[model samples]
Target: MSSAQGGSGEREESRPKDVEAEPAEAAAETSAPVAQETSETPAAAPETPTEEPTPADEPGQAAVTEPPAAMEQAAAPEPAPASEDPAPPPRAQPPNPDGEAKPQRTFTPDFLTELFRNPLDPGYADAAARKAAGNGAVGVPKKILSGVSALTLVALGFLLVVAYQQTVADEPARTQARDTLIEQVQSRRENTTDLSARADQLRSEVARLREQQLGGAALAELQEAEAQTGLAPARGPGTRVTVGDGPSPIDPVTGERSTEGRVRDTDLQRATNALWAGGAEAVAINGQRLTATSTIRQAGEAILVDFRPVTSPYQIVAIGPDALQREFRDGVTGKFFRALNSQFGMSFDVARIGDVTVEAATEPNLRQASPSPQASVRPTSSPSEGGR
Candidate 1:
């Protein structure tokens, strides 16, 4: 019996130790399942690492269990690769299908239109208000000023009427004075006409006396002198040159017909000079005789020969030998005219005439004179007469 009891006590002590060991094994098994779950689901595992702790484990045992779970979570794969592409850029609103963008209206015209609208116009409304207010800005109404002006004008008119009456009252005396002046002018004109007639008669008498006293050679010399001095008309075979303004062309820059295309004074002068150089004895332009002192110049737009205005188409008549035409063609005037024809479309014409007659030039008045020494001296009485 004693041997049996000792064996039973020893078996009971071994049983208690095995029971404690079984609880520890059971805790390890439960922890092994938790570690496996933490490795599989790492994202959730970090949040609750110390999941439900065993009641039998001490604080030190729980601390040790947490480190292994944290290590397992760290070893987990990185989060599923970020979604492949970012959300497509917010789609832009589709463009309007109707039309292009409308332009923004500017401010100036709109502002001005609003400011100058009928009721808002400053000129009308402000002027009316200023006038109606009678604020001394304008001092007096336009009607009162106009009435005063009318009254003043009426007074001036009355004064003018009085002056006119005085003038009318003196009209008879003025008429007598005017009659006297007219009589004096008529008498002077009649005297001048009589004197001119007497002078012509005296000239005719002198010519008759000269012809009777002088022989045929002297008469011929006088005639030649008169012709050379352009005192008598000339008739001969020569050329006629006509220069005229061309049909005007529109100016490119000014958009008007150019006046430069017209015949000028210089052009006529050049033609006259060319004719004279070609041995022209007598030259006449536009029916006016060209004397030694005649001038070809421009006065305003018209050409003046000896101060007399002549219009185009200018006809220059020359009395010379038939060779004048040939000489004129080879002269500077011919070249210049050709250039005008090509460049400005001027009109130049030349023709030979068999019977060309040029009128005589007007006689000139004497401008200066000096008395002879003999005429200036008065004769002294003879010495014999003085002695007597």
Candidate 2:
């Protein structure tokens, strides 16, 4: 019995040991679950995310998840959008609080394209075309100005020409009238008003005719006798002179001066000299006698002979021996006339008159008469005065 009891005691000690080992093993297994839970808690905490996380904080998750999908999409290339403007929406937007819809912009692209394509504008294409074709600007402004200027000049020239023409047209008539006037005045100057000697001669002729109061036959004989006497009629040998103004000096180019042309004083003097050398007894220019008091002066285009105005076609009358006059005209003076015709185109005419009678120059009239003495006492003494 004592041996049995020793064995039981050894078993019991061993059983205690095994029991303690079991508990220890169970504790180890339980502790292993707790450790696993701790590891899994950290992973769940990341998923639990207390707030939104930034990309940097979730980098690892982002890389593993979203990045793979994005990378795959990126691998396929995409085309760029076209430059065309976006189309408008089908529906219009609601009006703003102001009750007005926004105005849409309308493009004028078509109009602009047409305008640019046209070649008529002031652009490079038009300029280039004109240059290549060697064309210049042709329009209204230039032509109008040129035409107006030409017309104005033509009108002005016409006016000037007309004025000159009028002056010339009146010259010939004026010259003729002036010549006539000068002739009358010169004749008056040469005539003397001395009547005393003429009255006495008239009384003597009356007394002689009265004393020859005879019958018809006797009267006829006395008349015949008187006729034979030198005093019966007036007769004399005299020269006839003619002075005339010549034509205007010939224009060297045109060969003759127009009506408006000027006459020279020198030409007048030359004509006068020719007449004198022609043996003219007495010469008168215009109507003025070629006396010492006469002078040929220039007054404008006309000439003045002894203060008497003379125009063209002046005539000088001379009285002298007809033969001598004929010789004078046909001699050197005639040669001069020929030269005048050929060189200067002057006109002249010479003629001889028969039975030329020249009256002597008379004394000028004196008008300052003295009052006649009262004839009351002389009336009775007229016969008594002759006796005394």
Candidate 3:
């Protein structure tokens, strides 16, 4: 029984030793396969100059040595043949933790040389040299620039054509609008003239009816009123005066024709006043009868007589006694006419006519006048005067 116990103890101690030896054997097996693989591969064969030293015959030595050999094999990759394989392209570095890529650097010998060159040196010579050498890198390609310019010009031309077409399309509407406005103005003028003629005819008819109702005295009164109010045409012996614009004068500074010497409203007014002062009974200017309310004025470049435009040569017809021509020739009008002729080179002519006719005046609008009730009432006598 004592011998049996001692043998069991010895066997238990040997078991631990066997366990440790098993691990070493496994490591050796793994390393042998790797070494064999390296020898077989042509790429890794050149690096296998000498085999890795095996561990010494000591406990735990194989485990330590095996791990280092494995690490070295992993660290040193096998090199590929230069002739059969292409060089790998440069790999981009990873971005920062913030996800921002780093800026790349560009370096050229010419750029570096220019950066360090002195500013005092002449740069024109270098520019000339570069231009003469016809370096393609100096500027953009001519073909590309020309293509861009052509595209820009084509776009501009297209826009201009579109604008012109739009204007042409709208032309008919614009012309129609202009013609409509002109027609409206002409129609209004014709309507005014027709209404004036109708009013004059009605007045003449009323005067004729009054003449028939109240004979001799009333008829004479009506005739006198018509003459005074310029409602009846006048035909009598009169003096005729004609005035015309002077020739256009040359501007000394601009060498252009000037209208300064032309007849004006003031000149016409002066001539008319002088004729009235010479005891003229009836007067008419440019075929327009002059009444109490008649006005001689200017509208733009035109002369307006009684709100009607008249052109040169203006003719003044006056009916008076046979001595009218003699009186007017010796009056202020004759002197003014002489002055105008000499100063402005205007045309002024006076003639005596045997019989001259003057047209009736435009009807005046009586908007505010009302018949007087007291005027129509007969005068009443007191009781004492009635008894007598």
Q: Estimate the TM-score of every prediction.
A: 0.46, 0.28, 0.49
**Residue range with the least summed lDDT across 10 consecutive positions in model 3:** 98-107
Candidate 2 weakest ten by summed lDDT: 72-81
Clashes of each: 0, 16, 0
The number of the candidate with the highest TM-score is 3
- Estimate, for each residue in 149-223, the C-alpha lDDT of model 3 and write its tens digit: 999999999999999999999999999999999999999999999988997788879877888898988788877
RMSD of each: 40.7, 46.3, 30.9
Relative to the true structure, candidate 2 reaches a TM of 0.28
List clashing residue pairs in candidate 1: none
Q: Who is ahead in TM-score, 1 or 2?
A: 1
Q: lDDT (0-100) at residue 60 of candidate 1? A: 27
Ranking by TM-score: 3, 1, 2
State the weakest 10-residue window (summed lDDT) of model 1. 98-107
**Candidate 1 Cα errors over 4 Å, as ranges:** 1-164, 170-209, 248-257, 365-388
After aligning candidate 3 to the native by TM-score, how far in Å is the CA of 51 from where it should be? 57
**Model 2: how far is 176 from its true place, Å?**
38
Cα lDDT tens digits, model 2, 1-388, are 3332222222112111222223333333343233333332222211111122221221222222221112111111111111221323324333333211111112222444323432222222222222223332335465886899899999999999999999898898899899989998877655533355665477568747765667578766664444222123223343443434345555799886663233356655765576556555555554455553457888876688756687766665565556755675677766766566565566666666665433222222224877556555667557666776
